[model samples]
Structure formats: structure tokens, C-alpha cells
Target: MKTGTVVGRLWASKRLPELPAGALIEVQLDHPRDVIVCYDPMGCGEGERVLITIGAPAAWWFLPGQQRVVVDALIIGSLDEGSPPTMPK
Candidate 1:
């Protein structure tokens, strides 16, 4: 999974029937000027740091019998008020 911060939301003029119903958000990665759009079912808000999965893993992460929605990036989890605990060296 990749980590990034939610930057903005996307609104399409027309909706696709095959796509899942959720908010499409823009996430900014650690790389300079690198950002991507991710599908969010977990109700993540802007400025929230999120864990995302990309490529085929993202599309398959849903249910088995669910329609095959072509998803490039998906927000799997969100970081809370504090940073994640680090493992000891």
C-alpha cells in the first residue's frame, strides 16, 4: 500500500453505471508534484492521510461477485490524529 494525503475531490458531469458509488478524491504523494485520483468508500476527507493500493490489486480488493469496476487507485485506510507507531530497529 502507498501513503498519501487527500488533496481534493473529483466531480464528473455524467456518472457511469458500471462504476461504484463513492467519492473520487485527489491524493498527493510524497514525490514532488505527484498526485493521483483514488476511490474512497471510507468517507475520507481532505487533508486526511490515507493508505492506497494501486493497479489490479485495487480492482480485486472489492467483493468476489461484484461488478468489475476498473479502479486504478483505492483508499484502503486513513491515518488518525497521531502517526502510526514505528517498529524498533
Candidate 2:
């Protein structure tokens, strides 16, 4: 799992049918200044701190040995008012 913050949202009305129905948000990964579009079903929004599971781990983390590439990424959770206790300074 990776820690990040929602930087913005993307609107793609046309996509593959295999994709899940959710918001495609741009998240600023905690490490580098890089931003990535992540699928969010948890309703996270801009400026909201979030937990993201990327690639394959994001899939198998669920169950039944799901393919990580197919279910490549997800916004797992959103943080409230405080900084995450486990987050580095």
C-alpha cells in the first residue's frame, strides 16, 4: 500500500467495459512529486489524504488470487483531520 493525496479528478466517459465504475482521481504519491490517476470507490476528493494500493497487490489484497494488473490500483481509504500517525515527516 502507498500513501498519497488526491490532487485532482479525471473525466473519461468512454473506457473499457472491464473497468469498474468509480472516480478516476489524480493522486500525488507521498514519495516523489509524481501524480497518478487512481480509481476511487471510497469517495475521496481533492486535498483529501488517501491510502492507495497500486498494481497487482491492489488486486490480490482482496481475495481469490485476483490479477493485480487487471485490478491494478485502488483508493483504499481517506484520512480525516489529522496527519497519519505512520506517515513520515
Candidate 3:
């Protein structure tokens, strides 16, 4: 899992049938400061802080029962408004 802010949204006219119902969003990672695209089934909007899952977990878990997606990244949850918790050193 990773923490990030939704920076933007993407539009696609065509997509795979296996892809679930959702919109593509761009997230700016808090740690490495890199941008990535994620599938959003929770209807996330721009500027919302979100939790993302990648790789196999994203493809397998973040969907309805017995269904799989082809996404590399998926938005799992949205964060509440406030400063994020500090990491222990």
C-alpha cells in the first residue's frame, strides 16, 4: 500500500472488457514524489488523499467477488482531511 493525493483524472474511450466500472485517476505519491495512474471504483475526485494498492493485490482483491481486473494500480481508500501521521524512525 501507498499514500498519495489524487492529482488528476484520465479519460478512455475504449478499455478491456475485464476492466471494472471505474474512472482512472492520477496520483502523486507522497514518498517518492512520483505520479501514477489508478483505477477508482470509489468515485474519488481530484485533490483527495488516497490509499493505493499495486501489483497482484490490486488485480485480485479490489473488485467484486470472483472478478479480476487488469489494472496495475487501484485506489483502495480515501483519507480524511488532516495532516498524515508521522512515520516512526
Candidate 4:
């Protein structure tokens, strides 16, 4: 899992059928150009620190009988900024 802060939301007029119902958020990481669009199941908002799961693990997180989704990045949880001395970047 990766840690990052939610920066913005992405609105897509068109998307693939394999994509599931979720919000698309922009995450700001360590690198200057490391902002990435992620599928949010936890309903995270801007300025919030989050935990993201990437690759096949994110795509296969659904329950049994659910369709296999194609999520490259997924927001798995909201992070507690107070507990961590170092927040993302």
C-alpha cells in the first residue's frame, strides 16, 4: 500500500465497462509529478491523507460473485495524520 494526500477529484464523461461505481481522486505523492488518479471506495475528500492499494490487489478486492474489476489504483482507507510524524510528502 502507498500513502498520499487527496488533492482533487476527476470527472470522466466516458469510462470503460470494467470500471466499477466509485469516485476518482487525484493523489499527491513524494514526487512532484506523482499525482495519480485513483478509484475511491472509501469516499475520501481533498486534503485527506489516504492509504492506497495498487495493481492486481486493488482489482480483486471485491466480494464473491462480483465482477472482476480493472482498478489500477484504489483508495483503501483514510489515514490519521496525528499518529504519523511524516505524512506522505
Candidate 5:
């Protein structure tokens, strides 16, 4: 899991048939220019700070029997309290 900011949303009228309902959010990773697009199960909107969990052994949990429906980041929840957690930059 990691902390990231919701930069934008990807609107796809047509997607994979097996892929479940969710939103694709653009997030800036822990590294510079490391921004990436991730499939989030949570209904997180733009500009919202969120915690993301990478798809792993849990990949089948969401996209079963298929490795193509990769969701490297999932929004766990929204941060409504203090500022976003920090790291050693």
C-alpha cells in the first residue's frame, strides 16, 4: 500500500468484459515522475488524497483467472483528517 494524490480520472465507455465496475485514477507515486494510472474500487474523486494498495496475490481477488485486468493501485479510503502522510524526500 502507498499514499498518493488523485490527479485525474479515466473515463472509458467500453472496457474489458470481465473487469468489474471501478474508476481509473492517475496517481503520483513515491518517486519523481513516477505517476501511474491505477484501478480503484473506492469512489474517490479528483483532488482527493488516498491510500492505494497494489494488486498482487489479491489480483485474482478482483480480476480472477486473468492477469491482464491488473490493478496495481486500489484506493483504500479518503483522508479526511490531517494532512497526507509524508516520507523522506
Candidate 6:
């Protein structure tokens, strides 16, 4: 999983039938300083830090039954306010 902050939301008039019920949010990644859109089911708002899962894991975890969903990235968890624990140097 990767950590990022929710920057904004995307509105689409049309979406695939296979897609689940959720919102599409733009996230700014902590490392590499990149922005990406992710499927969000937790109703995360802007400025909230989130944890994202990508690729097959995201698709499988978010989808119900045995159907396939076109999810390149999915918001798995919302982060709390505070710095994460650091590893030993």
C-alpha cells in the first residue's frame, strides 16, 4: 500500500457497469510526489491522508462476487493525523 493525501474529487457522468458504487478521488503521493486518481468507498474528503492499493489487489478487494472491475488504484484506508512510525537508522 502507498500513502497519500486526498487532493480532489472527479465526477463522471458515465462509468462501466462492472464498477462498484464509490467516488473517484485524486491523491498526491508522499514519495515520488505524484498525483493519481483512486476509487474510494470510504467517502474520504479532501486534505485527508489515505492508504491506497493498486493493480490486481485493488480490483479483487474492492469488487464483490466474482465479477471484474477496472480499478487501477483503490483507497483502502484513511490515515490519522500524525507522523507515521519510523524505522531504525
Candidate 1 residue runs with Cα over 4 Å from true position: 84-89
lDDT of 5 by residue, 1-89 (tens): 67777888888778776455677789876544477777776777887887766756436556445656545566776777675657676
- For model 5, what is the C-alpha lDDT against the true structure? 0.69
lDDT of 3 by residue, 1-89 (tens): 89999899988878887776678999999877899999897999888989999898888774576475678898999998895735647
Of the candidates numbered 4 and 6, which has the greater lDDT value? 6
Cα lDDT, all candidates: 0.81, 0.76, 0.84, 0.79, 0.69, 0.84
Tens digits of lDDT, candidate 4, 3-64: 78889998876987778766999998643438888999888888898888879887777645
Q: What RMSD does each model have against the real structure? A: 3.6, 3.3, 2.5, 2.8, 3.1, 2.8
lDDT of 3 at 2: 91
- Kindly indicate the candidate among 2 and 3 with the higher TM-score: 3
Q: lDDT per residue, candidate 2, 7-85, as tens digits?
A: 8999878877556566889998887658988878788867899988888766665466323235577888887678643
Which parts of model 6 are misplaced by more than 4 Å?
63-66, 84-89
Q: Candidate 2 at 8: error in angstroms?
A: 0.7
All candidates: TM-score: 0.81, 0.76, 0.81, 0.82, 0.70, 0.84
Error of 2 at 62 (Å): 7.1
- Model 2 TM-score, all chains together: 0.76
lDDT of 1 by residue, 1-89 (tens): 67788889998758776567789999987544489999898999888988888898888877686657878799999887775434346
Instruction: Give me the displacement of residue 27 in model 1, in angstroms.
Output: 0.5
Candidate 6 lDDT tens digits, 42-68 = 999998989999889888875477477
Name the lDDT value of residue 16 in candidate 5: 74
Arrange candidates by lDDT, descending: 3, 6, 1, 4, 2, 5
